[model samples]
Target: MSEKTILVWFRNDLRIHDNEILLEAVRKADKVLPVYCFDPYYFQRTASGISKTGSFRARFLLEAVADLRKNLQGYGAELIIRTGNPAEILPQLAEQYQVNEVYHHREVAYEETEISEQVETALWKLRLNLKHFIGHTLYHKEDLPFPIKDIPDSFAVFKKKVERDSNVRPCVPTPEHIVTPEITDAGELPTLSQLGLDEIVDDPRATNYFQGGETAALVQLHKYFSQDDVAVKSKSSRNSGSNNSSKLSPWLAVGCISPRQVYWEIFKHNQDGNNQNASLLKLELLWRDYFRFMFKKHGQKFIKAKTAEDEAPVLAVNELDFNKWAHGETGVPFIDACMHELNATGYICNQCRQIVATYLVHDLKADWTRGAAYFEEKLIDYSPASNWGNWAFIAGVNDAKESKYAIAAMQPKDMVSDFVTTWQPSPIDEAGDLMHV
Candidate 1:
């Protein structure tokens, strides 16, 4: 009998550490092949006129993939890189590598699931199985106390039950060595220009560069967990004039580190399970699980479908207010500061994100999906469920009354401070008091 080979396809789960799909492939087959596809669909400019993957996100992705390849090399394997549809790329790689099966972590979002289905269909024709592993969530889906269908719509109730009843599974051990067939070519990593985007000129104030990789992710985790103000930082307001909040989201978004890894490290550092600061940090990770599980339970519930060509921007109004908000040109100082930081660094504090989002939907009376699409393009930490779910909540599905209240409560008293001065447009737009003129 010939030796069996399994191709491990890398999606959001980029790291070898704590990755079950990588382990399962190695355990099941005699040799393992690791691959990451830069699917063009993700990099394309949608009709919404927003990039599917913007400069910041695309660059971060390239860095993460490069790091993954390097890590795989350390473990005695090469990361096979390709730029194309996964549906086309996987089948071809399967044939080239003589792979009996292909394994990947499952995704809950609509487009990701659709692409997975397409790849599954293509593999079916070649008589190779497309195996999927559920490794993205901190808690294994099977271990959940309630089924996806039964998950409470209210986040409060959901958090309560999961904490009380469920247990987070241990991290999958990283293999000492990953075996692969001799390979002459593994393809080149694509650049931002190739992905149809301008190069990123990072803002000067961005002193803390977010390096992408499991290596960097682990470093940041250790440093963040070691801080004495873990509770204060974990509960840091999303509404900040500065961009110096937590840095774990981009790593989490790219899958350089698993939520389980972070959770366990907190457990180790805190020792006692009942530590409040540790619980808050874990709660932050739990929010990620909440959005992902919510997506699984209900598909695209928050997004309103486009009715006609008139709604071509697709998610929200694509007019002046939207463009101004996207560029941080809006006259409102605080909102402008947050948007500028987001546009420049691809990140902003959660408090600022909510404030700016509210300004767009409530103050500006523009559609909410527009802000969601912009974030989808610019945010380094953009996850479909979290981005869209938060936007939907801020958009206030029940009524405008709730958003009105939220905006009033969130307005900063000292909006004219130095943080705003640093980010707002030069010359201060004499009428700076204006809102999105």
Candidate 2:
């Protein structure tokens, strides 16, 4: 009898370590095939008229996929790379390779869920089983204190309950060896130009230059916790306007590093002393989990409005103002600096994200959806749940109302002036008048 061939589809969950889908496939099948698809839809222009995947993120993804392929090779397996819709490519691969099963991490966001469903349907017609595992969150869905639908709308309530009740599962052990059926034609990875994106210039002023992959992720985790004492410094650094937060989101967003792995590391570090840091780290992870569960419960509606009773106030879409904001040309010095940093590096610290987001929604009175879409395009760490959820929260479209007044009350003129004097000179507006706040 021929060996049972199983195909492991790689999505955002790119890492090999603690990968439930990959682990399960290896256990159940005589041979496992690892594959990644660069869906063209993601590279295409979004509704906001920006490429859904910009150069920085595109380059990061390419690096991640390359690393994944290299790691798989070490295990005597190959990662097949393809460019197209997964729905079309996966089913064809199943037929061609006589794959008995397909395994993947489940996605909660609307578009990703739709694509998964399409692929499942196509596989069903071919008599192949499509299996999904929960690899994205720190706590498994089954282990949650409440059913996802019953999850509290208030993050505080939800966090209190989960922190008190939920347990963080240990990381899944990495497999020593992966057996694979003979395969030829391992496709080449795509370049940024091929993906219709221009090359990204490195920004020296950026807080961190992100390299994508499990190896890089693990190295970062060690450096932050061991050498940097991230826990002790994060709070002070944040208050002092130093970007010292654990810059782990990019790796976390892409599943290059599992949230559980991060949780355990923090847990181990806190076992000796300073439980405060561990608590803070876990709190952040819970927030990520909350967004994912919220998305799963609410679906597309999660991004639309906070509640049915609360109607979204009609806001005029200002194209010129939005363009200025997106390009970091807004004359408000601090806001402009943050936007310019984001545009250049595909990253900004959490505080700056809130500052710019509030500016876009409250000050500029532009549609929050436009800002969210732009972040989706530009952020190297873009997770649909976290990105949209944070945007909606700032836009006052979530259960919690962020204080727009408080954000607006902040004095940015001084900060911008200081930044300009210390750093690069501010971009000049040809007109004598600075752009209005």
Candidate 3:
């Protein structure tokens, strides 16, 4: 009798802890073969002509993959790495290993879902099953108070309902030991240059302090919640020069950390006394869940801006101006400083993201997709559902109250004079045009 072999396909969810798919795989299979693919499509150039995976994100992912490989080895399993389409590589691996079935976490976004579908179809052709588990969001799909299609268009309403009715289940424990089939030659991880990205220099002004992987993610979570009262100070300190927003998004985005883990930690911390800070953090987690559910419900249509005819009127974008915005040369000093920060680093604070996005959509009048695509390329913490869904919400595509044409009402001189003086010392005229002082 042959041992039953299963393939564990690692996608965005890279961690071994509280990983439902990996847990089930180990429980059922006599032997497991773990695999990760650097999908070429993800590294290809976007329609906007920038490399879809920028150097900052590329380097982080490389670090994450390396860490994942190490962790799997600790469990006596090896992660076989490959570079190509997952739809193709997975099936070939299945054939080579004679895998009885495949297991992985499901993705909500259209492109990711499509790739999963392709792999499933390929596996079916080989008479093998491809199993998917929900692990991305704080709430599992089955545990939602309402069906995904019935989720409230308003985030506030959705949050209220979920808080009233639902609870986050406890995290699955990490496996003490994982069994592996007889296999050798666990392949080497790729470099940033190999992934078609240029080497990135560390930015002195970057506010982000994240390194990728499950181990790093755990260290950051403990440091943020247990070491100090960082939570109590978050709301007051956010958006100011002395900002202290919890910089947990990068790990969350990559599934290096699970939302349930974060939720429980904060919940436990609040037991000491009344802590509105825990409520605020949990609210942010709900918002993350809301966007993911919205993606599951609406699919690609969720990415569009709301227009009267279901088609947005094409705006005459000034390519030169858009380029300036992309490269941090926008003469509006505050906006320029934010853009420069984003370009040099892979991140900007949440407040800066909104300000720059509003400036581009309402001030520059460029299509919102352009800004979203650029962010996709740059952000190390990019989640397709959160990134595109937030863009749509900002662009009035989501069921939020529409934004007024108030860009003209904002006086650049009054709002950003001090910030500009510190971060961008160049003189600007009343209209925010660069001028010789």
Residues 273-365 of candidate 1: C-alpha lDDT, one tens digit per residue: 555546656767777787788788877663443233323242445588778877877777777777877777877756667677877876677
Candidate 2 per-residue lDDT over residues 1-437, each given as its tens digit? 88888999999988989998888888888999899999998999865568998898899899999999999999999999999999999999888888999999999998899999999999999988889889899889998899988988777888779878988888998999998877888899998988888987787765568898998989988876773365364544323433235678888888899988988898877776565545666667877888898899888787676466786675796688889888877778778877787788887666567777878887787888888889888888888888888787777776643332244345456356655422232222111010000
Sequence-dependent TM-score of model 2: 0.91
C-alpha lDDT (0 to 100) for residue 133 of candidate 3: 89
lDDT of each: 0.76, 0.79, 0.77
TM-score of each: 0.87, 0.91, 0.91
Residue-by-residue lDDT tens digits, candidate 3, 225-279: 7533653545343323433345678888888889899889988888765565456
lDDT of 1 at 160: 83
For candidate 1, the per-residue lDDT at 115 reads 97
Q: For each candidate, how many residue pairs have backbone atoms clashing (under 3 Å)?
A: 5, 0, 1
The candidate 1 region of ten consecutive residues with least summed lDDT is 428-437
The TM-score measured for candidate 3 stands at: 0.91
